[model samples]
Target chain A: MTGVVSPMAAPAALRGAGAWKPAELLFWTLPVIGWFAFPENLPLLTQIAITALFALSLDLVLGVAGMVTLGHAAFFGVGAYAAGMLPAYLGIGDPLLGLVAAAAAAALAGALTSPLMLRGSGLSQLMVSVGINAMLYEAANKATEVTGGVDGLPGVENTPLFGMWSFDLYGRTAYVYAVVVLLLLFWMARRVVRSPFGVSLRGIRLNAARMPALGVPVNRRLAVVWTLAAAYAGVAGALLTQTTQFVSINVLGFDRSAEVLLILILGGAGHLYGALVGAVAYMSIHHLLADIDPEFWQFWIGLIFIVVVLFARDGALGAAARIRDLIRNLILGRGASR
Target chain B: MTILFDGIASGMLLFLISSGLSVTLGLMGIINLAHGAFAMLGGYVCVVALDRYGIPFPVAVLMATLSAAAAGVALERLVYRRLYGAGQLDQVLFSIGLIFVSMALARWLFGPQPQPIRLPGWLQGQVQLPWIEIGVYRAFLIVLGLVVAVTLHRAVGVTRFGARLRAAVDRPAVARGLGIDVDRVFVVAFAIGSALAGLGGAVGVELLGLDPSFPLRYLVYFLIVVVVGGSGSFEGSLVASVLIGIFDVAGKYYVPQVGSFIIYTVMVVMLIVRPQGLFGRPSP
Candidate 1:
């Protein structure tokens, strides 16, 4: 326990303080702002926004809670199916109610799984979660009469948000709706992470045994955190279904789960912004590479992963930090820093 | 009856491939998920050797195993070395990365389609068992797995090298202090693990065939066997694998609806009930 110093107790070194320049803002944010301002690009912006939120939800578990799950797509799938099937199967024509159902269903499933999952270490936790997802996937595939098998469920006509805004195919409504949801979730996540409970989670993640010794119910805390993360994932899934109006079996696939994990890793887990950066970078690369050569794209992706792991320990953020350091040192001559 | 025999053969092959993973994981506390990928690569290589160069089946398998072993050694030096004591998450991330790299390389070299290897003419045809006729190749596989298992059991359970390896595992730092070459031990263990994976891949392809997703799809089965058998217990892996194999076979053949998926759930239950596995030592 002597060398087991929690990251919380580490000195606040101001690692990225004042590093974001105005030009950098112009370089990144302006394009995004411009794209969103255009009517044609709304759908694309909305998709990115939703995906960013989903990645953020996964970050709550992998990043903040220090729980790595290989089966989070199960929760995502749960939400998607809830939103999709409620209308299609149960004849709940109202999309708003359907979305709430999706979130609530996923939250329920998460609550059920959290206790079993929260007790294990990373490997066992990964295995159990993965097992649960695989079982769910199998069930989803087999329950063809109910789930539509491999063909997927369709015909989801989403009502307008608050009955005032119709979701236009041009993606205007979806984009704004997604943006609002993303902002709200982002703000809530920020508040949650900054709370005392979040502090306790950090403490448990750093050293679980010590927390129990310090009177914290480590397992119970983990269960609650996992459930919250699952609820977030469920929301993302519901949004995906709502926007697409089609729910496929691939939502709960291992590749989806693995990709989410890769995004979190690439984005640098532990930072809220990491999930956003990771989703954007990963999806953009995937889009770019698929356009180049669908067959050979994985090769390039694999190479990038290798390079990221070998060089960028902190991933893309580390690269950004390095560039910032270089610019700062160049401006104030190396000899000027005392 | 024939179904039972076929299932047995398949289970034996899986056990052969997974045993290496179990041993290395037990001793080194390293979770090498890339083990299956290596096996898949071996299967692909053997397929190419037989199909492309018109090489003999036995020769192709030998070449594949040797090449896979070499790859294993290289992996140990390059990637596995960095993962020691780095936590399970790091091992998983790094190994998963390696799996992707291996998969990418396999796809690049062999393409994505399943490589159907033609068994040597001698190994073809069915064998007349007491109750039923079985595929001659499958029967041969079962015998081979048993021989390997027995030989390994003797090597690890009876030999001085096994004793030394156990000693090393038990007190790695002290073993180093006592002048044992710990690095060499690690390298050898990894090589042995990869070799087992290669061996498993070589045999399994005869029945299951070669595919890109082979490694990932069967990863849970392998990990479950290792965990249930208790890490570091070769005999336990054998016992656990056999039990799982029989259960899987019976489940698929008889009760396909319930048992196939429940295997993993059973594993979870077992872990909850006996965290150290049925026969493993309690956590220190």
Candidate 2:
């Protein structure tokens, strides 16, 4: 909580506080480029987008708000179930409607659980989050008739995007749809994290006890951010369900929660773009490693985690920054000597 | 009647497995999520010895315990020693990483299937008690668990090593000033905790099942024991483990559909009511 480097050191435009820079614009365009450049890999690209969004949501909680959680998948699963159930049970297949329902359901869950999270110390908070997740997983597992149990909810057919672009086999439509949602949500998140409210969140994260003395409603702010993060995660989950037309209990699994947290950390926490970078790196590595040996990929991932924690500490981005500083210092020192 | 007996028996097994975790978390302030991996390792060792090498059950259990302790010592010296002053997040991530590595290693060694073990004839079959018959293995587990518990209690309460350990944990600087090797005490405590986990794994294999996913599967239960018992409180873990075991068994028996939902709900409620846990000191 104390050592989280703020995103202020990022280049001004990348901080998302001013007019968009060409690099910022180009970053979003890469997904669009991938849509055309790698048509066959659209499915994987789409998954990467969804996972990035999920990681972004986690960053808001763990990175910005400084809350450590292992149960964020509870919100993701809630959103997924909401979206999936809408089409299967209620015959509402509108993608936009599904997104809304998912967000609301997930946000509601966050609101309900935030009190518990707010009451405990870091260790207790971790335990409470985990406990909540286990309860939800068990509940979902037991509600076979409604959730389709372990077999996963079937017959989730969504209406065409805007009643025009039908999802095709090659996943072109799903890919575009997912990227668009990610862009919109990412844009909103960027704004929120740069706002005064966002600044206050950093303050609370740094020193919660002193924030209340400054007249900041510490618990209320945390509750709001936690809910907002849940909504973002819910949207990610909704996109997953819409693209795949499947909702399995695995969405709520502990692995998903752990995976997303790792993704955020691997990219670098507290930096908005780090989530995006981390997700892409993680999924790509996962894809390549799994191809080489499906079962042993975890071993490599574990090794990476250990190395990262021991050396990089701040993740991939942090390591890059350190190398950059080292080169710059070396050049400056040589110039001064000369 | 049978349900109660079964609940207590299973509870005893739970205490054995989680007692190690409680010790580490309470005394060392390390959230060792990989504790279950050590348990799994012991179970695998015991299984391979008894099934493949034709080793006797008792000797296999002893070997399992020793191996796990050795692994614990190695990890402590190599990895955990550096993480003592790190944040909870780093410790958590590190242990989780260890879990993944151990899991993959287990899959490679054991082929992703639940390991099978053959209990000796003496430990097999039902034992007649005056009113009810109980599985001999379960009865043995209860006796073993109690013996370990009492011995551990006395060791921590009466022995000079225990006094040094308590001194080191409560006031590290003062203990070091008093010529106590705090680091050595921690290493010993960690090994002892891991040995207990191994012992639990060897004996509880038939009941809990052994597989690559064993660590992740039983992680929550161990965590529950540590958290609810309050970190650093030995008796608290015992009480919490027994309560959770009974609840888990009764829930599965009476409401098979709900399964573990009941216990999870209870845990959540307990946490909400007492975030510091049943016997823990209030957070600073």
Q: Write down the worst ten-residue block by lDDT for model 1 chain B.
A: B255-264
Q: Isolated chain A: TM-score per model?
A: 0.83, 0.89
Candidate 2 RMSD to the real structure: 4.7
Candidate with maximal lDDT:
2
Q: Which stretches of candidate 2 lie over 4 Å from their true place?
A: A1-16, A314-338
* Residue A47 Cα positional deviation in candidate 1, in Å, after optimal superposition: 3.6
Q: Please tell me what DockQ candidate 2 reaches.
A: 0.79
**Residue B26 CA error for candidate 2 (Å)?**
2.1
The DockQ figures for the candidates are: 0.40, 0.79
Model 2 chain B poorest ten-residue lDDT run: B275-284
DockQ of 1: 0.40
Regions of candidate 1 where Cα sits further than 4 Å from its true position: A1-34, A37-44, A314-338, B257-259
